[model samples]
Target: MSQKELTIGSMTVFVSQPYKVPQVTELIGRNEELELITAAWLAGPGQLPLAPLLLGEPGVGKNRVVHEVARRTGKDLFIYQGHEDVTAEDLACAVRFSDKSDRKMDYVVSPLVTAMIKGGICFIDEIAKIRPRALALLVSVLDERRYIDSTLLGERIVAHEGFRFVAATNTADLEGNAMPEFLRSRMRPVIPVGYPPREEIDSIVRSLYPRLNEHTGKLLDLFWLEWERNGQSTPPTPRDAIYVFNLALSLADFESLGGLRAMSADGEPFRVDQPGSASSLKESHLKRAMRELLPVSRENRP
Candidate 1:
C-alpha cells in the first residue's frame, strides 16, 4: 500500500481520496455557467480563486458542471458531501485507528483537506447543510490566504498552488438558515443554476441515453406538457426529466417483453431488486412516466 501523508513543517498530515474523480464530461447547455467557473479559477500570485456558490434546486446539473470543470482542468476532483452533522474536524482532518498498523492512530485528511494538500478541485455538495461552526473552517482557504487550520491535528494545512474550491446549495436550504456573513463574504457572486432549456434537456437526454434518440424529442414534449399542467411553480428538474425518460424506456421494454417476471440469476424465482427488463424509450411510454415524475393536476393524475 502506498503511504498517504505529507509532512508540512513538523506535522504529518495523512491524506485520502474520499470520492472518485467524476467521469462525466458533458455540460450540455451550461456554457456560460462553465465559463464563469473556469474564469473564477484563474488566480495569480497574491490572489485567491473566487469561491463561488452554485445555487439551484435539487436535480439541476450543479454537481456535474463542477465535475466537467475538474476534468477539463486536468486535475483530480474530490467531492465532499456536506451534512447537518458535519463538524470542523470533518472539514479539515480526523484521527482514526489504522487497520494495518497495530492500532496506531493516524491522521485522515478530509476531501477538502486532501484537495488542499494535493492541488486539485474540492467541490462540496449541499454546502448549506453544514452547520455554521463547521462551515467556518473554509474561511482561510477561500480568501487570499489559501490555508486551513485543523484543530484536530494542531496544524495549518496550506492549499497547494493549484487547489480550487466550489460549493453547491439548494434554494430551500438557503432560505431556512442563512449562511453566516463571514462565509457569505468569502464566497462571492453566487451562481444561480437555472433549469436547462427544452432543447438542452433533450440534448442531456441524448447524451445520457442515446438509445432513446428517436423518441427523445417526443418525450421532452410530454415533459413540458406536465411542466405546464402542474401550474409551473416547481417544474421538473433535469434529474426529474432524466428519470422520466429512464422509466419510460423501462416501461416500453416491459410492454415489448410482455411484462415478463424478473427472474433470479438461476431463473428459479422472481427478482425484487430490479424494476423488470429494460429497453429503448418510446413516445407513448412517456406520458405516464412524466406524470409520475412531475406532479399533475388532479383530473390528469395517474
Candidate 2:
C-alpha cells in the first residue's frame, strides 16, 4: 500500500492507497462521527455476556468503533465478513492437503475459530448476510462460551477466558432486518447509530486530511452544502468528505506554484471531474464515497 501525504492548513494528511482496515482504536479516535453499540446475549439472564451489536447505516463507521474497542482492550481481533455463502467451515476450520503425507492430518483454523481458541475478539461484519445455517454455528459459541468440534478439527475446542464477540450490521434494508430471535436473545444492549453533526464531521475531515487549506476546506464545505441542501442520491458522509479531499489532492497541483496558493489551476481550487460529470456516477456511488469521508447534511434546512 502506497501512502500519499498532503498539507491542509496546519494539518498534514496521509492518504493511503488500498486503504487498510485501520487499527480499531486509531479509526475510532481518528474519526469523531460514530457511536458505541450495545446488545443482549442469550447466555442467560445475568449470565449472558454483553455482546455489543454496533448498528449504523452503511459506511457510518460501526466496524471502526468495534475495532477501536478491541484495541483499547488489548485483544487480538479476528474478523469475519458475513455473506450468503458463509459456512460453518468459513467460521471454523476446513480440511486442507499437503504434498507430503508425513504431516498430512491437518485442519486450518478460520479467524473465528482461532479467536475463540486464543480468547480474542471476534468481529463478524454484516452478520445478517449470513444464512441461518451459517449463523447457527455461532449460537453455541456465543452462548455456551465454547467452540464446537468441527469435523475437520475433530474435537471440541473451549474458548479462552478473554474470548469476546462483536457483530456489526447495517440493517437499513428490510432484507437484512434483524438477527433471529434466538440469536437476538444472545445479544445484549443494542446500540443504534445515526450520522454525525456537521462540526464533528468537519473535525474528522481535518484529522484525516490535515493538509487541506482553508480554501480547500471550503471547497469540501460546498460539496457538503450542495448534498445537504438537495438530499440528492448521496448524502454527505464522513467517508465522502475524506474521499473528496483525496480526490482534490490528486486533481490539485500544489507543487510548482508552492504552498496553499498552488491549489488553483487557473485561480480556483480544482473540482473533481467536470461540473456535470457527477451525472456519469450514480447517486449511490457519490453517497457511498461521501458517507465514508464527508459530514452528514444540516438538519434545519429544507
Candidate 3:
C-alpha cells in the first residue's frame, strides 16, 4: 500500500491508509464491552461522541474488541501505536523526503490525523505509554471542539462529523504511568476487559481451529490442568489458550513429517495418512507446548 495524498490547507499532505482487518471467525465473549463502546460513540443533537478507553491486561483482547466493533460498524480503522518517545507533532504530521522530483519534501499525516480528516475510527494502542505532553493534543479532539491544530502545517484541522476516537492500554501501564487528569476526564466510559471464562475459551479455540473440533474438549481440559499445575491464580487468557493449541497442532505436524521422511527413505510410497490431523495431537504434544510457551517459574508465579 502507498501513502495517499490530500490537500489539508495550502500544503499537500500524505494521509495514512486504514488497517486491513484480519480473518477471524468472530469476536467471542465481548458483547457487553462492544455495546459500551458503541454506545459511547453515539451522538445526539446536543451531544458529542464520547472517546472510550479500554483497559485490560495484556492479551485480554482489548484491541480485538475495538477491531470487531470497527468491522461491525463498517468504519475505516486507523491504528496508532503509542510509545514513550512519540512527540505531539508526530501525532499530527511529519515531514519526509518526497518521491516526486518536482517536490523537495512531503508532509505526511499520522494515522490519528488521517482518521480525523477522513471521518474514520482511530484506535490508539498502549496510549498510556505516551507522555502527557504529547497527549495534550488530544484534549480538544475528545471534547466538543472536535479539532486539532498542526503547528507545522499552520492549519486548524477540524474533524469530520463521523470521526470517532477510542484508545486502549494494558492494566499494568495505567498503574505505573497514569494519564493526565484532563485527558482522562475527556475519555469517558472506561471499559474494563477481563479474562474469558473456561467455556468461552473453549468456544474461541474451536472457532479459530475447526480442524481440532474432535479433540478440542480434551485439549481444553489439558490447558486448564496446565494452568492449575503452574499455580496461576488467573485463568488462561484467550491468547495463551490459542497459542497452546496452535503449537500442539504444529508439533503433531512436525512429528508426522519426520515419520513420513523415514518411511520414504526405506522406499515406502510417500503418502499422507492422516498426517498432522487433529487426531494425531496427543497429550504429550499439548504438554510440551504448555511447557515451552507458558512456563512459569516460582519467582514469577502470581
**Could you give candidate 1's per-residue lDDT for residues 171-215 as a string of tens digits?**
998995568889988887699999887778777787987776566
**Model 3 pairs whose backbones collide:** none
Q: In candidate 1, what residue range of length 10 has the lowest lDDT sum? A: 270-279
lDDT tens per residue, model 2, 1-302: 12333322332323212213454213524333223332232234456456767667886667667666665556677887788788876677655564446656334566776676666777888887777777777778877556655655455667766677788887663154446777777765566655766775677776665455444466555667656665545544566556665555543333223435645567876543433221122233434444544445456333
Q: Model 2 Cα displacement at 107 (Å)?
A: 1.4
lDDT order, best first, reads: 3, 1, 2
Candidate with the greatest lDDT versus the true structure: 3
Show model 3 residue runs off by greater than 4 Å: 1-3, 259-279, 299-302
Rank by TM-score, descending?
3, 1, 2
RMSD of 3: 3.8
Instruction: List the candidates' TM-scores in order.
Output: 0.87, 0.68, 0.91
- List, residue by residue over 1-302, the lDDT tens digit for candidate 3: 24478898788899998997886688888999999999999987998899999999888899899999998899999999999999999999999898799989998899999999999999999999999999999999999899999998999999999999999999989985489999999887899999988888889999988887677788788888877987776778899888988888887876767655656656866555554654568889888998889758585666
Best by TM-score: 3
lDDT of 1 at 197: 74
